[model samples]
Target: MTVTELLDRAHALGSDPRNTNFAGGNASAKGVERDPVTGGDVELMWVKGSGGDLGTLTAEGLAVLRLDRLRAMADTYPGVEREDEMVAAFDFCLHGKGGAAPSIDTAMHGLVDAVHVDHLHPDSGIAIATAQDGPELTARIFGDRVLWVSWRRPGFQLGLDIAALKEANPQAIGCVLGGHGITAWGETSQECQANSLEIIRTAARYIEEHGRPEPFGPVIHEPLDEVARRERAAALFPLVRGLCSTDVRQVGHYTDSPEVLDFLSRAEHPRLAALGTSCPDHFLRTKVAPLVVDLPPEASLEEVTERLRVLHAAYREEYAAYYARHAVESSPAMRGADPAIVLVPGVGMFSFGKDKQTARVAGEFYVNAINVMRGAEAVSVYAPIPESEKFRIEYWELEEAKLRRLPRPKPLAGRVALVTGGGSGIGAATARRLAAEGACVVVADRDLGSAEKVAAELGARAHRPSDVAVAAAVDVTSEEQVVAAVRQAVLAFGGLDLVVNNAGLSLSRALLETTVDDWNLQHDVMARGSFLVSREAARVLLAQDLGGDIVYISSKNAVFAGPNNVAYGAAKADQAHQVRLLAAELGAHGIRVNGVNPDGVVRGSGIFASGWGANRAAVYGVEEEKLGEFYAQRTLLKREVLPEHIAAAVFALTGGDLSLTTGLHIPVDAGVAAAFLR
Candidate 1:
């Protein structure tokens, strides 16, 4: 297959949760390339790069290696494995346009004598692969179609062993790597993929026949139960969240997928859940073992808190002991193991990370690992790589290097934010700024498409693109919608840390000319909308017991009213008043309420897009072309206020500088003396 076609198939395999999780596996294809130096057809292998996901694999993501050079490098490592030296040699074998770090399994792929090779951690297949009697079972299940290789650390030695097995059993289509995963190969990509899928299905059927006593179906639940679960989440989430916090500021995420539910609901859950990962690659995300926090459904809030405290203390001690055991052999002394997966007896799994998407990635892999182990326990036993081997994988310098490649966490890395009217104007700019600083933002607007576009743009640039931003359709005036939006944000990102209330409308008419509709829309969106958003956001922040920021986008007209803009000015005045009252009310809880009063932001703003500036220009007896210059000349700074300027001011208030200040309005209009703080 062409490289593009191979990537497409690889993505199809990796994206399926049943097949692989958290970029756990890689694939490669052998192709002939014309050597630029000698017009000769030289054999090259293109393997998946180290840090890129198969789900988003591109041609550029594949690391190209000259097959012969890689094998020659392998020949030099004849005895005790030096992982570091071996990796350097692999890097040295890069052929053409091949600087990307090849997958750690590249040598094995190059050694396989097939045009196409695929390695996967399919849950069903791994369940059997990690079983204690995996070798015997392999003979019984595939009956010599596959060879069985005993547990070996992945490095130069493992590559050599795999090649030896292939040489001895030339007719075998694939091999089951005991205590690790599955490797399949064929002359074509389709044949290799089909071989892997058939093995996975056959193993799954075998597991079902031998392991489970009863057939399993999806867990049934009523609509009200889900509502109750969310309610419980609001009330008790903080207790567990507090236990998981590495410090006072960082927040963690909770995952409650159907797969998690199934695994946590198993009969021997506590024993099975505490076991190690299905393979070493999984340890990168889930740690060696999970931390179990058994919160019974009937437990009271006080009981829940006490149980979590006790469990957290014990989990920490166990992690310390595990590290101590391995630290002596680890080249660099190991760091303390932080809990990755937390299992709640009655609830589903909750995975912790520095941010939301990191947590999601860890959670997905852990859930898959749990399913695989359960399948193995049913038939025989889930005997994954032993503790010593798992330690090597966890502390390996080459593997740890990947974590260092990520940018340092921003101040708002673990925080969640909500931006009303975020599809356009200052709201959109503010959402982007917050997302850039590492906050998971919700872009909420009446325009779903615009909101989605804004969210998509932010997500595309984020480190964890999938979880950085989400779009929500909200009419801020409706109490139900406002409350629902807050709940959704909490459910999606675990909790709320900041809220920007920016949705508003304008009515360019005097009180006498204004209809009730005009007055109501302006007041409802500006005055009432800000109130609703602030109230709901406060509710979540208070429940979280974490200090947060609530900012309102008001108008300078509140202090300096325009001749025809009565409704808008009066409503903004009321909105500013709401900020003060909210600040006074929520200050004790450390929830800061503030406002940014901006005027004449004509560029890239909804107010200008909707022609509000043209109407105002007519009243001022100036052309629309001169309106920007007029506002610029009017400000003491002699510069027109841009949406980004307003957005920067909003971020300033939410940031550390004004952490002690609240209930104040900062103007963004070129100094309007009349609108200045008295």
Candidate 2:
């Protein structure tokens, strides 16, 4: 088969989430190439490179190596202890692209005689592959269809083992790597793909017939409303993350879907999950097992927090003991990382990572592992790769290299910010700026699509490896939605540190022409909305017991009145007053509340984008396009107040230099005397 066709088949195999996750699994195809110097046909093998996702595999992501060279290197390869030498050998034998690093398993792929080879960590296959009785059980089911390779730390030794196994049984279709995954091969790409799927599907069907009976998994508890669920998630995630962080800052991601809640509901969840990962590959991302926290249904938030600390301490103690038992006197002490997964009995599970994306990936793999464990236990006893094997994999130098490659985090790392009306204007600009500074941001807006778009944009630019941008549809005026937004921020990024109350609506009609609806709408969003959001946000900040900043996007209309703008101006005036009162009350909790009053920000703002500028310009008998210039020329500094300018002022108020400043207004208007703070 052609190289393009093999990649297409590889992408097809990875498309199934059940087969492999993002940036996981590898594949290869064998083809002949013309030697540049000799102009003679030479055998070569193309394998997926490091960091390449099989779901989106391309020719560029494949590393082509001379088949004869690879086999020759393997024949005289150094032992597993010499990982550096092994890597150098692979690098020196590149026949295709020279820059990309091939998968560490390329040696094994080279040893196999098949023209097309694929490796995957499919959950079903892993369920059997990682079982203690996996070899015996696999032989019983697949019989001679597949061979079972015992668990060994993935490296040159494992490759040698594969080569030995193939040499012994050249007719074997494929082999299940004990406590790891599976390999399938054929003379054609289609044959390889079909063989892999057949193995996975057969294993799944066997589990159905012989595995554990139904109803063993937990049941979904009575459903909680969106707001209630988010509230609890917000309050508990921070405590869990704090405990998992071990003096370092860690971002957390939580999941409480009905399926997950049901899984946690099982009485034997802790023991069942503690059996270890469904496959050895998951150990790198999820660690060995989850840290289970017991929370009775009647426990209060304070009680839960205290219980989590105690349980987390116990987990750490156990991990230390485990490491001590495994280490040799000559080996450097392996630093123990926090348990990647946290199980809250009667609640759900939480996952921790340096950033949100890593946390999510950990959570996803943990969930899959749980499912596999349940299925395996039903048919037979669930047994994972031995602790000795897992310890070796966890401390492997090659696995640790992935973490070392990550870029250093930027400033503001571990902080969480919520930006209201973040879909556009100063709010969106502020969200992007905060994300760039290494803060995880929650983009909350009245429009869900807009918020999601902004979140997607910002997430793409995150400076921290695990930092994330999340979106929430929220109406600041609605108490339920406002509280939920605060909870969303907390649940997404551990806790809230910065809140920007920037959502507003304007009524530009004269008093004689204004209706009650115009007056109430303006006040509901600008005055009442800011009040609700600030109150809820302050509640979360206080619960976290961490100092935080709340900045309101008040208007210059609050200080300087404009004709036919009674509703908007009066509401903004009331908002500015509320900020002072909030500061007075929240200051004792180390929460700073301030306001930014921006004047004549006619361009790149949501207020004007929604037709407000056209209406205001018509009232002044000027073209809408010229209003920005008009406002700029009218200012003392003769400069337009851009959204970014307002964003900078908001940043200043929340930053360290303004640590002692509160109960104040910072104007973004360019030297407008009337708009200046009193």
Candidate 3:
């Protein structure tokens, strides 16, 4: 391949949806065999190896190596990466060897003998391959130009397929491996790279042109009743496990995808089976369609079972046909029992895989695909790849193997979090930090402007103005308001996974001067509000069956009682107790509850300032400035505790990053909570 061709391929691969987010695929090319300086075959194949993002591949990422040696090593080792390592370790193969380890596809590339080879995981390609008609579509587009191999676990089989294809069409430009990705090889590295890019780019464009339209109707609905929910989950789990023969994650990744949300939210879910999975590779993990169990309220167990049997039979037939059309041979080894479609009574659909991870991936794919199909149906009629075509690619041995490989940076992605009082100060800061770390944040505050501002700054999708104190205003003190807020959050973002209850109020007064009204007023906002919110949050968290995190915003006064601020201190102390009680209650449900006792956060302005200011002056007979200075001086760091610092403490607790730290209070007062001397 020429340099120009290589550049073009790189650009096209980056643009292609099939290769979208390709973080660890490779591309390479080689010349005809020639005499080496040492009088041996000196054929050089340029291959992309580890740590290369196909979306942004450059010439430097491609490594040049001896094709014969690479192929020979593949014969010894079952996979390309292992073979490449063997060659790298030997001095005899050091002539054109780069220091970098070759891609897992290096051995496959050598076997193909094509001058150029390119591989990528384009979003569009995955979309097409994931369709029910993936095999037929593949044939329709590439036909004889590209060989469509059944999904196979990558490594030895991949190399074998390339070797077979090369023998049949010695000059074939490239081959599209169902489910996994595509590989292209030409007379030169550049040509092969260009061909590979063109294949995926063209495939992606074709998919986009024929892709499903936007969904036309509402997607979310009120959750099922407790009895119904438990029954549905229990019934669906076994059915899904049987179908995919994998441990199901029960709750799939669809909760995060917009398309899934739309599809699941629809009043009447139609053409669900045709949606397939999100990506072709996911098929090995999750079967094509989730079982839809739309049981009427009056339906009996027998009726539900009959309906499930009918659906199961239909699914099996479709799966068989899909495989027959796409599979090269009728006797291909099956991964497990015939894939089963889980029937989720009243709840929606889910795909099954061999493990929880795979099930979740497949479920996510199906949800997105369904949404897309619904959208397209709205625009016109949805026409996803037929079941037969999808089956072939999904069951392809090589593609199924790719499902075993996992992605990096787990733990935080797609998780939902709510940050109360998040419009400004510590709440706002915590929201931003959680968002940056991958959790979807719901910013709630009494000030709509403040809430919206934080949401806008963080680019969060959920923002609501909620007063956390008043049973009527914030209603954090009211079970009704608290329930409503939580429900709204879940409805808006799909689920509630984290909660940062950083909303409260404080008042200062000398014990002798403090009235009964003052004590009640302070207690109402801080103590009562915290209790109400925590109680409501616990209920919702338990219902979701998604273990959650709660971090209450207590003050150091809860521990180190401040002078003349008896009311505020008393309320804070109660708040701390609430955290412990909530934690103890919710622990069985996997919900972790904790508290942050910030001594003095100088950065939170407005009501916080007034409350703290009033207390500081009244207690110490000092100005606000002097009190702040004194507080700072008392800290080991001698630094003012900014709202951000306090927010950070809250974030750590609620993030689940500190899983075992529930019922504990972290002081973010710049060490003032620890210092005894004033």
Which candidate tops TM-score?
Answer: 1
Candidate 3, residue 653: how far the Cα is off, in Å? 6.1
Which parts of model 1 are misplaced by more than 4 Å?
A: 38-41, 214-224, 247-254, 329-337, 447-449, 460-466, 508-524, 558-567, 574-593, 607-615, 623-629, 654-664
Ranking by TM-score: 1, 2, 3
Instruction: Give per-residue CA lDDT, model 2, range 552-623, as digits (tens).
Output: 899889989789999999999998998899899989988898999998788878898788898889898889
Q: What is the TM-score of each candidate against the true structure?
A: 0.88, 0.86, 0.60
Candidate 1 per-residue lDDT, tens place, 1-678, comes to: 568768977988887867777667888888888999999988888889887777778888899988889878755775755655777777777887635687678878988778888888888878888888899888888887888888877776777777888778888888888888888888888898888787778888888777755222233322124556566665555555545664434455666666666665555666666777858767777888887766555567678667877887898888878777876654555555457777765566667677876778788778778777777777787778878778777887877776677777786778889999999988899999898877889999988899999999998855565589988889999989988888778667777889999988786876699999989998999899998898888777876677889999998987896799888899999998998999999999989999999998888788777878888888888998788888888888899898898889888998677889999999999888878877
In model 1, which range of ten residues has the least summed lDDT?
Answer: 215-224
lDDT, each prediction: 0.79, 0.79, 0.59
Model 2 Cα shift for residue 75 (angstroms): 4.2
The backbone clash count of each candidate, in order, is 0, 6, 45
